[model samples]
Target: MQNISNSFFELLNKIQEKKKGDDIQQYFAEVADYLFKHVAIQAGETRFTFAEIEFYYYKEGEFEGPLYNCTYPRTRNVGKFFWHYSGMDICFESSEEKKYFGGILIRSIKRGSEIIAGPMRCSDEIMNSCDGELPYLVYCETACETPVSTIRYGIEADKNQNMKFCFYIEPETWNRKREGVLVADKATGRYKNVSKTDYYIAEPKKR
Candidate 1:
C-alpha cells in the first residue's frame, strides 16, 4: 500500500510537469491513458480481472449524473449497467454463486492548460451544495470482483488553485461490507433506497 501511495504521487508529479496547452480534451485523454497504464493496471496486478474502463464527463456543477460517457472495449450499451446502479453491494448472482463487482472512480479538473487528477472527496456533499455545474474528468474501471486490496489516489485544487494530493488503501474488511440497495427513482431518475420488491432483478433470488 505504501508503495502504491508513492507511485500515485510520482504519477501526479509527472502529470503536473507535462501540462502544456489549452486543449482540455487532449490533456484529459493523456491523463486517462496514464491512469489506466500506471495506476489502475498496476493496482489490479494480483487483485481482480480487469473487465472494462469508462470515462465520464460531468459539466461543472451539474451532479444529477454524467453528461456523457465513453467506454473502452467499446459497446453499444454504454451506461446501461454501470450508471444505472449505485452502492457497493451490486453483484450478479447465479444458481451456483454470487459474483461481486467493484471499481474505482478517479476525478480530474483543468485549470488553464494545467491538469490535476485524483479522487475527489466528499463527492455527494459537493454535488448537493454547489450552486453551479461542476465539471469533472472521471476515470472508471470495472473489475470481475471486489478487490481484496484497493488504493485510491486524488489531487484537488482549492478555490485559490493550490493543489493537494491524497492517497489511501482500503482496510482489510473493506470488501465484505454491504452498502445496501439504491434504486433509481422513476420520476426524477436519481437513486433512492427502496424495498426489495421495488428493486428490479433479471433473475429471481434463489431460495
Candidate 2:
C-alpha cells in the first residue's frame, strides 16, 4: 500500500496532472481515510498550544488571498481546538463567509517510516461514533472539481456522513491566505464557528 503522506501527495499530483486544467475529485477513499486517521487520533489524544489555517478564493481561474479574516489562532486541547466562525462578535474575517465552524484535530506521530491515522480515519468509525452529539459537520471534497467551476466542495454533511459535502474554493489563493481551518480563542467576546454553519467567530461585527 502507498504511504499516507505519499497518498496525499499523489492526490495533489493527480489533481494537477489529469485535471490540471480540468477540475476533479481527489478520491476521499484514501485521502479521507488518512486525514481521518490524523483527525481521530488527534481528537482522542493529540494536544497542542494553537495553530491557524487559511482559505483562498478566485473569480474563475485567477486566485488570490491573504483575504479578509483568513487567519485566526487555533486553541489546541487534547485534539480539541476551539474557535469562532462568525467574526461579527469575535472580529474575525473570512472571504468564505462560513456559516458553521468547527475544528479538525490531527495527531501525526511518526511511527517509524510510516505514518498512519487512527481508526476513525478509515471509514469515520471514530468520527461517526458521535451520532446525535455531532450535530452538523462540514465536508471537504475535491471529487467534484471541474474546468467549468474551478472550485471545490466544503459543504456541510451530517454526522452520518450522508448528503453531499460541497463548497467552492480556489486552490492557489487558498495556499496564499493560509486562513484558519479551525478557530480557537478569539480576542473578541463574539465567537464564530459556534454552529455547524456559523463561520464568523468574532466578538464584534465587521462594520
Candidate 3:
C-alpha cells in the first residue's frame, strides 16, 4: 500500500522507493505512451462508495474497506452497473483484452442510499449520511483495452453459497477510510447486508 499526503507526495515517495533518479519527464512520457497505446481500446467505469452503518449481526467493531468496481461482460447485451465508492477511484489494464478478459470490474464500497438494482442513485435519504454529501456515484465508463487489468470486473462466489467479497485498501484520508471500515460491523455500522440473500448476484456489470 502506497501512502502519502497528496498526489505530489505520493509521486515523490514512489520514485524514491524505486531509487529512480529525477527523470520526471521520462516518467511522464512513459505513462503518456502507455495511455496512448490503450487510447482506442474499450473501457468501463470504476466507482467507490463509502459510508457508516449499524448491522444486526455482529459483536465487536471491525473495519471494512468498501469495495468499488465496474464490469463489462462481453456478449450480445452489454449490461452495466455504476456503484457508489464514496472515496475510492479506479483505473485498470486488461489482463486479456478481447479473449479471456470478460470485462472490467473494480471493487470499492461505501454506505449507499439504497441498493436498488441500478446506477449509483444519489437522490435517496441513505445518501445523505454518506461520507460525501452526495448519495450516488457517477463515473466515465469507457473501453480501453490496455494499461488496465481485465480483472477490473467484479467477482462471483465459488458456488459454495458461502463467500464474501474482501478488500484491502490504502486510503488517502482518515475520514474516508474510517467511514468505509464500519459498515458490516454489528458493533459499529452495517452497509449492505447481502449475507441474507440466497443468490445475491451483484447489479449486472457490463457496458
Candidate 4:
C-alpha cells in the first residue's frame, strides 16, 4: 500500500484502476480504515485537551473559551477515534458575514518505512458520535503540512456572536504545538459544510 499521506491521491488511483460502480466507495472505505488504525494509535493513552480559537474575518484572535471543557480520554487500544460534528457560530457587527463553516481532520499513519498523513474522512460511527455537538473539535497527529482544515458550512442570521469559527487548536499542555483553524458558521444554527478556502496559522504573539 502507498503511504497514507497521499491516501487521497491513492484513492483516486484505485478508482481509476477499478471499473466497478462502487469503486469510489470501496477505495474510500479502505483508506478510512487505514487512517483510523494509525491516527487512533498515536493518540495513545494520553488525555487530549480540546479548545476553540475565535477568528474574525480570517484574522486570528483570542481563544474562544471552551464550549466543551474537560480533558477527554485518548485510549490507544480503542482502535478508533470519536468524531463529533459540532455546528459553527459566527459573529458580526454592522456588516460582513461568514458564508459558511466546516472542518476536516488529518493525521499521519506509518506504512512500513514511510509515514503518510493527509486529508482523510471519518467513519459513520465516528461522525455520528458528535451528534448534537455543534462546533465540535478533535485532536490529531500528522506530518502533513496542514493538519486541521476548515471551511464555511451554511448561512445564518447576523447576530453579534463572539467569533466566526471555533477551530481546534493545540493542547494547552503541549509545549511545541503549532496553531490552526477548525470550524465556521453564522447565527443560522444550521450545521452544513460549505465552501470557502482560507488557511489560518496560529500566531505566537497571541498566546
Candidates' RMSD to native? 19.8, 17.5, 18.1, 21.5
* Model 2 weakest 10-residue run by lDDT: 48-57
Candidate 1 deviation (Cα RMSD):
19.8
Candidate 2 C-alpha lDDT tens digits along 69-112: 13334322221223344211111111223321222222111221
Q: What order do candidates take by TM-score, descending?
A: 1, 2, 3, 4
Best by lDDT: 4
Name the candidate, 3 or 4, with the larger lDDT value: 4
lDDT per residue for candidate 1 within 12-120, as digits (tens), equals 3332233223343343344334444333211222221121122332221221121111111112121122222221111111111211121223332222222222223
Compare the candidates by TM-score and give the number of the best one.
Answer: 1
Better of 2 and 3 by TM-score: 2
lDDT of 4 by residue, 94-187 (tens): 1113221111233222222222222122222223334354222223444322123222122121122322222333332212222343345567
Spell out the clash pairs found in candidate 1: 60-133, 60-134, 60-135, 61-132, 61-133, 61-134, 62-133, 118-154, 118-155, 119-154
How much is the lDDT of residue 199 in candidate 1?
Answer: 22
Model 3 residue 89 CA deviation (Å) reads: 8.5
Which wins on lDDT, candidate 1 or candidate 2? 1
